[model samples]
Target: MTARQHDTVGELLARSHRLGADPRNTNYAGGNTSAKGLAADPVTGQDTELLWVKGSGGDLGTLTGEGLAALRLDRLRALKGVYPGVGREDEMVAAFDHCLHGKGGAAPSIDTAMHGLLDAPHVDHLHPDSGIALACAADGEKLTRDCFGDSVVWVPWRRPGFQLGLDIAAVKEDNPGAVGCVLGGHGITAWGDSSDECERNSLHIIGTAARFLAERGRPEPFGPVLEGFGPLPRQERRERAAALAPLIRGLASADRPQIGHFDDSGAVLDFLSREEHQRLAALGTSCPDHFLRTKVSPLVLDLPAAAPLEEAEARLRELHEEYREGYRAYYERHAGPDSPPMRGADPAVVLVPGVGMFSFGKDKQTARVAGEFYLNAINVMHGAEAVSSYSPIPESEKFRIEYWELEEAKLRRMPPPRPLATRVALVTGAASGIGRAIAHRLSAEGACVVVADRNTQSAEEVAAELGGPDKAVAAAVDVTSEEEIAAAFRAAALAFGGVDLVVNNAGISLSRPLLETSADDWDTQHRIMARGSFLASREGARVMKAQGLGGDIVYIASKNGVFAGPDNIAYGAAKADQAHQVRLLAAELGELGIRVNGVNPDGVVRGSGIFAGGWGAQRAAVYGVPEEKLGEFYAQRTLLKREVLPEHVANAVFALTGGDLSHTTGLHIPVDAGVPAAFLR
Candidate 1:
């Protein structure tokens, strides 16, 4: 490395340390960072050392030259196949398992091998909030092209150890003299002959993303002012927990025959799901290198046509069977005898929708990155779902990336430059079901999500369930009032730089005997539900428009809005107007590039005070039963006889708001468990 390049690395290494106290550094520790060094094995046999990597437990500002341990390239490359977890690490060192010389043997940074592959004189990697938002974005590669131009060559995620190293060489050959590559879902990498260019690129990419995120419409950016996000219903959590512990252990077990007890840590339960951890599916992993290890997708918590453990297991088996079939097909098509064999290439660990991520990796890096990337994928998937979809590399492309020998070599070679590495997102009404689910999803995807709700306590509660503090913040907002909505959006822009997806799921529902409903009641309902939705959407659009960003404006309407409901006259009427407004807004905002859409969900409950408090009780009275029976009522109302939750509704919203919805506008998608045969169907 040149003196100048060395100096650039030195500068970033310095600035990164400054990130510690900054709120933007929220979850950087859970993430990783690295740098390329000066020593190039001396041609004169003078030992030209080339790289120094981040040692574990060192914070950014606290870092110094000593903070990084030095490892030689050739020695580093030799440790590739000394299988991890086969025996104690120290034991292997004493046994001379591989080249083990780091002075103190602080396991060379996890991304050590990948860094060596860049071949660039100097490089830097970071999982900053800004760039991660975009990287963790669904189809973020495309977004990168749209925003940063095609100058950046994006490589699909892969396992970083051996494969990434080799893949980088292959990519270097494919592209022939490019600046650098980006690992989807993981952090970013930037390299230059001069350290300034490298540092500039890193900051530039991250800054670009930070600007993009700031421009994205985050409905509200409140801090964790919420005293609490509702605790998972313990009684229900326990019942479900007891019923599923063995099942979870079995699903996660590598050795199926053995009944291994699960480690019920707070982290595990913290992610436990009333929705059966289907939320986990929403967060498969946030980094791209994890793509290879986790196989680009995760298992979802989808119960089968029938339930009771056997049926659930059977359905899950079918899912695995399909993955296997797809994997076999992909391998057969892509793998010739000449093809390299990759372990865990076939997305082995499936996300049982409501359950947390599971793994079948050979070691910790694979397991951990795969899991983190899965979580990242989940957030982007869900957040994108809120905006539009979770589309990644196309199926054909995924197949190629999964089995491409050259691409595999690239991933193993070098870490990707941060795509949308460090960005923050704010989603409103992110407390209960859909909002909570989405907040968790975005957080896992790498964007710090500020969960907003009227219930301050519940909002904070949701934020807590996610990592902690800045990673996810919770706040309350009454979407109906223009003042509140404006303030909320302002707060969000202040908090996370700006917003990405402005999800309006906050509204009140009131069911009444048509004649019994007074005009005042009608006006009140309109203000809270319809008017409130408009206010939030209006403010979000203003901010986005001002920021020169055209983001997604998602409004949660009801299935009744598509048609009409006699009992829910006011809500239905208001919602119909809301849906119509979305179409109008879509048309008007199309020029602004801000996509507007509505989600019509049926049979949803236990979320808003509108649904559970008023609507449910009123409907229950009409049915001469308890209010909790609302799901049965709505399910029976539908042909499928199944209830849809707020998350499913949010999913449809997610699908329509991103790049996939690039061509779509003025549409009302439904997430009603297959309700409204003609409309939803």
Candidate 2:
């Protein structure tokens, strides 16, 4: 086919990216796009009309040509004639698989049938938050007609499948001039002869809904904000989140423990603080796309501003129990005997009166995704209220989408989860150097990391770089202060329920000879390097012991601990003390399932605050070389003549904390690029 006759897969992918990039339009793999094209059959070598649609389990924002599954249009259309009635979901999926043009590619989206039947060259479907507000309203059909006139057809709520496709096609046939159709309690569909026209139709429909809501004279877009409720500063909000995390984690851990994420964004806080939050939030999700992430509804808690921790904890337990009972009953009432077993009865999002929103998942990323969708759901619900009473799809339709085989199949096709999928890690001095590398590596392995450092601004910067509040949290920690260290650990526990791994890497260097060093200089080095490590380790042990789950503590010691240096008396003495502290702590805490270890790294100057704070220049002076040549000098000192990097040290720390050394503790691993003088026997 000529390019003028049909849109290419590249054009389709670009359309998907534009639609998916906006969360208000579509969230977390929630939308689908398709284009009609021609391709040669592998067997017959004859040109055939093919539909290139967004594949299952692929995000439209990052869609590629390879991510689109090509299917024979004739085969997909023939299925309607083959079934002739309410088609079977299983057979439809199998038929789509049979029509796949390539040997192995992503599975076609569940909406392929609808896209194939639409006749338009380009079709864009999205669960835009504004449009869904109108789609799920009690008078959604009336609202759709009022907003878009006859340009948009209204299809009542129908469980998406072969039947839904047929319904959409039937609507199109009656409203032949319409540019799109609004699926009640579902989403909007816009189609045109070109991708640009489809996108314009989508934006027009969404804008129409927004204008309709604004003209409804609701005075304000959101609900009435309750008195005595306001936003909390970031640090204070984090502290509160930390205090509530263990309780949520413990409750969610009934079958298997999960990491908890706190969302105290202004939007979340505003929604939760509303006087009518509890009554309104129970109305269920605005669209079926949110069913998988947020379940049926959120668990709302009545936490008073003046409530103590104990009282709040007790209330949380009661609310969780109520939520579980409600979930079980909802399942029992809706699920068919032949349906797959129900998913775990856990609340994905929890709304607390004074604490904002908390989302739970097996890991940080998943939890954050849930939080994001829930926030968007709030926006839709608010919009619906502003226009009229908020109405959701019926319970039966929700049940069908939640337990649909195709949806479950997409999840099943995902790659295996990482080893530290649900684990939580806290790394001290993580603003830069080895500590920063460790934090990033741990997050890459699926652990929720707490970036703690004395440099509060730097810690915040690091957390932002690691993907913000979703994956990492910044905490102001001065390890030398017991109170600050305790608070930081509390924040970590709150951010992710409980800490599973602690890396004590905060240190300072003093290279003056013993006779030349002032008492103040000597004390400063020992206090930060030795005393700080001791305090942080003790607090981490206390938390792990209380959690009743064996944890890991990895101390970042130095090569000088094993090899004496003439001018490095204070630093050397402190490093030696830290190494001994790890061994002793391991012996004492091992019985509690806590593993303690140490990594002795030598001359890791780059990115490290110690070297940045004139330590490199001091060492360079001693070596009679320029400061820039110090790294080369250290590299040559190693047996391998290779420069050791902070990332290399991070990998070693990951090895110890991530079950590689589970059965072995009290060991000091070297990460100095095979330095003969620093090698441990």
Candidate 3:
């Protein structure tokens, strides 16, 4: 193929995105793609050969032009002369920057050498499960031969570096007809003369390998599913997962806090219940991408599926400590004088016998992705065992990659985490009004939010708007029902390990005189507001105690709770109950490191479910003002003459719990624009 047939950067990006969009093609952020083409040199106005490849840490499926690093082909290839051999390949990564054409694009990936040194005009290095399965098999080379004949070759394991690139290039030169090679104990590397052809070669390798495993592989690669280890009924499974999540998360976050993700997918359950699960799990994953996210291995909870909860908890603590010690030893065995310090000594992924997997990271996305990558590892293991004994790269090799200077550099380049990076918040009645605003604010500050509301649809919509289930999840809760309140808190535990922040914002109001208010009206008001707050608090406190993590519970009480408002009997009493509960719980939970506070907003009529649902009009009539002027009437009554919106109340919630107010508990913040009567004296 001629240089004229080379793909443009745009086409390269399109190809990459397509490949990345499918998990079958490559794991997330696991592959690199490159296209060599000619571009007019900025200095000389002369056509110059250039290499454009995926940048460091960029996912291929979401590859944008900005995510591609561009370098002068001549300069890049010239590094071959200065190549300080395999022992000093780490220096080669820094050298890639010297070959940059203009500002380049994204930071050049460590795999840059593999693409630049390769002879092909287009190259793709991917971590597809099927291809990785073939790569990880003990008889990988032999299987490669049977799977694709000579159309694809086999390359022995070598840590990813300049030498590995040279080895692959050498293989390509020898096997002139080969379109790709199964990278032994790694993944696959495919190449073509054109972008379209490169993609085809990649898909061909993946498809062919998958088919080979499916057709030629033996049945029951994982052995029989152990009877006592099979997944429990759906409800039981979830209950177990929720019950176990807090303990796992707390243990994993010993060194540094981590958000959690739970996966009960069929694939995970099937793998966990198999007889060979322990043996294979101990072997760890083969792909560097897999271990990078999931860690070198997972900490498995070894117990019968029907183990008692107390026993499970005790075993989990023991397992976590053992895992930590093992991790430290692994680091010690591999650390060099210049090696980066061990990041942490905690398991990123944890597996339970009856429950699902729990994965932890700095944020929800990272946690979720870690679980997904582990699933990929499961697939690879199953395939490898079917054809041949599963074999992973040696621990030393993984250590080199995990603590590589280049990888450390990439880590350094990452932006600092958000304020609430590892925190999870459960906001009651979060579907709309002040609750929704609070949800948005906490999420903006980096907390994973559980949008708890009776309105499931609206709650889900709010969760989606906050960035889907990773950043936020919807949990239906009437708050009044102890069962539903428990379920909502359980959802928070299941969705994000456990709750760090709970906003008791669910409430209802009724404006009626003491003479007119019936016992039923009073009961309803107290039931939905005061009683609901109590139920949510009780449930939230239980999870927080289980996690052993200090938490915040902020009650959205009203000015009416403190101020004696005219013609307000039932609603005022409920608010007063909620307000006092804050003080009472603050004192009770202080020893547990739980801080309780309340926000007193006079009337957030603009964006309030309570006010919008006719309370605004009722209050307007009580004040003898037009419904449309109710906000103005309330504002005029305030010293500041300001109309408080839901956002104002939301801001106060953050102020109390957003770190600065760490020591300020049992405090009531008035977001009422400044109503003197409502001021807490």
TM-score for each predicted model, relative to the true structure: 0.44, 0.85, 0.97
- How far in Å is the alpha carbon of 238 misplaced in model 3? 1.3
For residue 585, model 3's alpha carbon misses the true position, in angstroms, by 0.9
Clash pairs for candidate 3: 20-61
The pairs that clash in candidate 2 are: 242-494
Worst 10 residues of 3 by lDDT: 1-10
Model 3, 121-157: lDDT tens per residue? 9999999999999999999999999999999999999
Ranking by TM-score: 3, 2, 1
**On a 0 to 1 TM-score scale, where does candidate 1 land against the true structure?**
0.44
Local distance difference test, each candidate:
0.55, 0.82, 0.91
Q: List ranges where model 3 is wrong by over 4 Å.
A: 1-7
Candidate 1 Cα outliers beyond 4 Å, as residue runs = 1-98, 101-425, 624-626, 677-681
Worst 10 residues of 2 by lDDT: 1-10
**Against the correct fold, how does model 2 do in TM-score?**
0.85
Residues 401-486, model 2: lDDT tens digits: 88887777777877887767788888999999999999999988878889999899999999998898768899999999999998
Residue 39 lDDT in candidate 3 = 86
State which candidate has the highest lDDT: 3
